[model samples]
Each structure stands twice: as C-alpha cells, then as structure tokens.
Target: MARYILDHSTRPDPLLAELAAETAAATGESAEMQISADQGTFLTMVTQLVAPRVAVEVGTFTGYSSVCIARGLSGGTLHCFDVSEEWTSIARRYWHKAGLADRVTLTLGPAQDTLSAFDQPIDLAFLDADKPGYPAYYELLVGKLRPGGLLMVDNTLWTGHVADPDRHDASTVRMREFNDLVAEDPRVTVVILPLADGLTMIRKNPDLS
Candidate 1:
C-alpha cells in the first residue's frame, strides 16, 4: 500500500533524485533523517498554495525538504535553521545546483537562539528538529507566524507509538506530550496526518493573529 501510494504521487526530479542518492551515500545511516519524496512533494504543493513571502524551516537535514519548498516559491524566501554545518554544506550545493540559491537562506546555530532573533512575520514554517525542543520551537514559531500562517511538524507519530497504550519508551512519551500540546493550544487548529511517520499541520487562527 505504501509503495502504491508513492507510485501514484508526483515523483522527484533529477536534482532531487541526485540529492537523495548523495545524501544516502555520503551520510550513510544519517540519511534516514532526510524527508521522503512524497513529503517533499507535499511541501512544495503547500508552499505554492500559500505563496508565502517568508517561509521558515527548522531542522533542515541535507536540504531535501528545503529544496522542495524553495522550488514552489514565486517570490518568497525559505529560511533554513540547523546546527550542522557539515550536513547543510551538502544542501547548499544542491540549492545552488537547482538554481534556488537566491530563494533560500541558511543559518547555522542553535535554533532556539537563531529563531528567536528572526523578526520577519512567518507565512509558513516547518519543524522537524529535536523532540525535546518542540515546545520551545512551537512557541517561537507560533508567536512569529502571521495570522493564518501554516506550520507543519514532522515525525510526531514516533512509529505510531504515540497512540499505543503500552509504548512507554522515552521518545514515544515525549512525542505524546508534544502532540497533546499542539492539540490543546487554542491559537491554532491541528490535524495529524499519518504520512511518513506523522505530519501535523497547524494553522493559526486569523482572528487571533
């Protein structure tokens, strides 16, 4: 079923394919951190629809997701924040190769510090960073997200353990807490899609913005 879903979805282009291949060969086990092709396609579609002037991505691993988002921009910039210079260097190369260097910006540092300093009203944001930092990132992103802005969070399902009553592992527990936090927040509407682990979409209410 998963394979069928992917087969039907829009495929990644050559540049994206090369990025995936290089990520796996170079990063080895860490390549699992990169978003899947379907997710990348989804990001592109959402960005196109939103047509945001300022988009933000937290936890850009190897830049697959960023590339997807940047490709969808008409006149917007995608701001990527990550702690690893090594991983993002590869991403930077791909961005340049895809001719999207002008539409994307990279910031290397702790997202807590870098994101707090970002003053632009975010029209869209993607969070796939450390699980423990979700709450902090959520606060900062939601605070800066303009009214009706969209925020997408990845890997919130933790292999579906978040819904399992018997799963007591630390990561599973932590993910559950984060899910609950988003669900309970009154400022945004939340929906968790069971695509690629779990993708949660949060849209800030325009009235409250």
Candidate 2:
C-alpha cells in the first residue's frame, strides 16, 4: 500500500532524485532522516497553496525537504535553521543545482538562538528538528507566525510510541506532551496526518492573541 501510494504521488524531479540518492550514499544509515518523496510532494503542495512570502524550516537533513519547500515558493524566501554545516553543505550543492540558492538562506547554529533574531512575521514554518526542543520551537514559531499562517511539525507520532503508555522514552514523552499542547492551544486549529512518521499541520486562527 505504501509503495502504491508513492507510485501514485507526484514523482520527484530529476535533481531531487539525484539529491536523495547522494544523501543515502553519503549518510548511510542516517539517510532515513531525510523526508520521504511523498512528504516532499506534500510540502511543495502546501507551500504553493499558501504562497508564503516568508517561510522557515527548522530541520534540513540533506536538503530534500528544503528543495520541495523552496521550489513551491512563489518568489518568496525560505530561512533554514540547522546545526550541521556538513549536512547543509550537501544541501547547498543541490539548492545551487536547482537554482534555489537565491531563494533560500542556510543558517548554522542552534535554531533557538538563530530563530530569536527574527521578529518579522512568518507565513509558514516547518519543524523537524530535535524532539526535546519542539516545545520551545513551537512557542517561538507560533509567536512569529502571522494570523492564519501555517506551522507544519514532523514526527509528532514518534513511530506510534506517543500513544503507547509503556513507551516512556525521552523522545516519545516529549512528542506526547507537544501533541497535547498543540491540540489544546486556542491559537491554532490542528490535525495530525499519519504520513511518514507523522505530520501535524496547524493553522493559526485569525483571531489568535
């Protein structure tokens, strides 16, 4: 079923496919951190739908997701925050190759620190960084997002461990807490889709305080 879903979904571009392959070959086991092709397609679709002028991504593994988001932007800019220069260097190559270098900016540092420097409104935000930092990132991103803007969070389900009380690992616990917080927040209407690990989409209410 998963294979069929992918087969029916939008096919990745040649550059995206090449980037995914290079990332898998280079990163070995860690390549799983990269978003799946279907998720990439979803990101691009949402980005195009929102047509955000300013977007932010918290995690950029090898640039696959970044490429999707940047490609969908209609002459907007994307600010990517990640702590690894090594991984982002690979992403930079693909961004350059895809002619998105001008539309995207990469910042190497703790996302919390770098994200603090931005006071401008954000039209869209994607969070796929450390699980423990989700709460902090959420607080920051939600405040920065303009009313009616979208915030997409990845890995909220944590491989279904979030619903398993027996699984009390740190990541699982953190995700569970974050999920509950988002669900209860009056600022946004939220829905969690069982895509990949789990993708939670939140749209800030127009009357958000």
The TM-scores of all predictions, comma-separated, are 0.98, 0.96
Quote model 1's TM-score. 0.98
lDDT of 1 by residue, 1-209 (tens): 88999999999999999999999999999888888899999999999999999999999989999999999999999999999999999999999999999999999999999999999999999999988999999999999999999999999988889999999998999999999999999999999998998999999998832
Instruction: Please provide, for model 2 over 1-209, each residue's C-alpha lDDT reduced to its tens digit, 9 standing for 90 to 100.
Output: 88999989999989999999999999999998899899999999999999999999999988999999999999899999999989999999999999999999988999999999987799999999888899999999999999999999998888899989899887788889999999999889999999989999999999723
Task: Compare the candidates by TM-score and give the number of the best one.
Answer: 1
Off by over 4 Å in 1: none
Each prediction's Cα lDDT score?
0.95, 0.93
Candidate 1 achieves a global lDDT of 0.95
